[model samples]
Target chain A: MARSTLYQQVASELRRAIYSGDLGPGDQLPTEADLMTSYGVSRNTVRLALGELVNEGLISRTPRRGSIVRDRRPLLMYPQRELTPQPASVPREAFGFAVSQEGREPSQVIEVSIVEPPEDIAIRLELPDGGLAVVRRRLRFVDGQPYNTNDSFFPHALVRDSEIVRPGDILRGANRVLEELGHPQVRVVDDISARMPTPAESSRLELEPGTPVVEYVRVGYDSDDVPVRVAVSVLPADKHLIRYELERR
Target chain B: MARSTLYQQVASELRRAIYSGDLGPGDQLPTEADLMTSYGVSRNTVRLALGELVNEGLISRTPRRGSIVRDRRPLLMYPQRELTPQPASVPREAFGFAVSQEGREPSQVIEVSIVEPPEDIAIRLELPDGGLAVVRRRLRFVDGQPYNTNDSFFPHALVRDSEIVRPGDILRGANRVLEELGHPQVRVVDDISARMPTPAESSRLELEPGTPVVEYVRVGYDSDDVPVRVAVSVLPADKHLIRYELERR
Candidate 1:
């Protein structure tokens, strides 16, 4: 049981304030000079304390705004919903439906292309050697802010004549399209891990410097146990939370 | 698309090598001077290129060893197994079984105590105001290395006389003990999120500088729908991967 350092003590106090709701999202933290005076520490110590909060993704600092508490209301995502059958009346995809349920607008820009898929995705989709795939890459947004990215890959031979190869949004959802094509997914496997965002991902998601991203990959299998679709999602850690419910059988 | 910088070009080449298996785990990367000569870049450019890989968790730098490709073979965790019933002969917990199946030794140090539970845990366990809980805090290890931490909290009134209150490993697991006490959990909800580790967590897990951690919380409810147990696991992102399989009904 070693004692915490001076900077850590200072950081702990501010962290407590944020967690206790004394300071909330969009609330400005005390300036460096004020923090120095209150903590009776040098400016360097105060800056170090603030840096800890930044790394924790609790607050963001700007030249003009100084330090402001960040929004921590992450969107809840249920991966099971995408595998389960949706009612006919609810045609939206899982992401859009989840977002709208929270009273937020969901939108995405899609780019459809046919190409040689990445090796990992090709294996997940069970593509043959040199086999191509149709990929629908989407930059999804909520409330006009870039939230995440979802890229779904399908064997080109199976989707060559389908709407999945077209360059636009599918309002009825791609899962339905797969069902209509007689390749309905009866099972899905999801793999999740987290890591720091790449430079490109940082720019695309407008992520904070220290923010990490969750890499969620789902491979859908048809009733015949053939892999059909592989969907990869890059979710900004600060803005997404994944949930699952299981019942003992 | 804008052109990538000189350093990014160098980094991408090395990244391709790693992903393509041209460079494998524990393989030493080219020396700084060698990279500078091959890429025809300055020392600063080479250092920046290596820094990208480090931030991506693809490599680790050391004063004596320079840089080496990290071991990316993450332990696959199946959260569903914990809820499923096992055979009479298999008494090990899900983690222990999984680790053994992978031919890795699993071990843990446990500390049991009774205390006022955290606010969130109290709500999850549906405990009344001022209700106490018996917490079994475990620092789990794999191959004699600190891997993760699992802290399970139970209502003190429910497990006061049970072995869960004892400070030692439970060979049959605490869940089995709960079942014997007529509190078999039939349903569970799991929430998964990730963030930078706290200082204490970083030291406990012996994580690298840029590593993140996954915070997984599972609340279990008995057949009566009474919440009985809440288990919180902090898994270092680099060492663990979570997987789930869903079948459509």
Candidate 2:
């Protein structure tokens, strides 16, 4: 195996320190001059090492602040679990349950309205052209900080008078309400991608500059293979990690 | 519903044109002055509307070239298919197969070596302290363009004499080789996250300045409940979309 270069070796050492909790979030790293002097390396090498940490999202460099370690604690999200039946004891929505399990306070502001769905969402929900849908839009917060947004669309004709059309949180989750309405989702398809956030999303989530967001979309189908619900989530890349487990059948 | 602002209205028109392919990839958008005149809005509104497209990653701006639509063709990846048995006629690896299915040629360069695995890989593979592993590192390509990188690691003691120790591309895939050697993977766990690319990765992948990368890690376990393989893939965020289908049990 080829040996690692000087800059890589330096980066590895700093990474180990950060991971081992020797250096923590918001802690300032040694200045470039100090690092060069201590490691017997050139200024370019120290800069390169620092660049690696910046790319890893472990540290941020500013003209005034130099290099400060970033908060690397990402919330774990199980996309698979969101489709399954939650235990009766856990009545909160998936996001709220997950955050509360981590000992974080979870809260959300919701607004519901009926409108002609977007083109992509119309196709996902299999609504007719010009068909209206009830959309429940939510901006979720963790410990009083905006974390993410979730927007779920349901066919207006199917859920016109249902609780889904009301402007409030569904304490038992909208999925359970779907089951009670005889449109239980038996299958779901999820698509995940990432990109820079729009100005509205950035302001809503209070995102720092250079932060990207993961767009997760799920199309759920009933037992008869009829598309019932379409959920779109925008999760800040720095604050969320998605996980899935698959077993061979 | 509240009406959209002037800038938002402008942005929506442009977004609709792009989505409808009326303004295709590489097509130049109207200049700020032209948009201001056409929409009967001020230069600030035009600039804000343009900023919206930039943040959405739908266009690029340069001094010489004002704004051009970006290529939005993302390679779709199914992480769940990697562990499943391939059809009798299709013997290629999951990545290769997926690319080929999209009517694109797939290729890769492989490098094999034995070394002590990284701390995270060691823990995932459940290797003892200081234990070594054989890693097959691949730089994959699509239609002659550098696409992504996949590194697969296996316990050295478990496959020392197997074909996995050699350097050439495994036409039947290393997973098949593992099955032949009595360590078929029966379960797998996938983790997905995104961050900016390191300088080396950016150069290697020939990525643009603002492109982030999705870091995907998968751990495979054999029927005996022993970890057999750990695969890590770094995919450029702009060039990949991951999808999964789930069913209620």
Task: Give the best candidate by lDDT.
Answer: 1
In candidate 1, which residue ranges exceed 4 Å CA deviation?
A1-70, B1-70
Per-residue alpha-carbon lDDT of candidate 1 for residues A74-165, written as tens digits (9 for 90 to 100): 77788877777778899898889888865667999999999998656765665666889999999999878999999999999998999999
lDDT of 1 by residue, B41-127 (tens): 998778767875774567888879998999864677899988888787998877787777656689999999999996667756767
lDDT of each: 0.85, 0.85
lDDT of 1 at A162: 92
List candidate 2 segments past 4 Å from native. A1-70, B1-70
TM-score for predicted model 2 compared with the true structure: 0.74
Task: In angstroms, give how far residue A40 of model 2 lies from its true place.
Answer: 43
The worst-scoring run of ten residues by lDDT in candidate 1 chain B lies at: B1-10
lDDT of 2 by residue, A18-62 (tens): 756678899999999999999999887787677756745678888
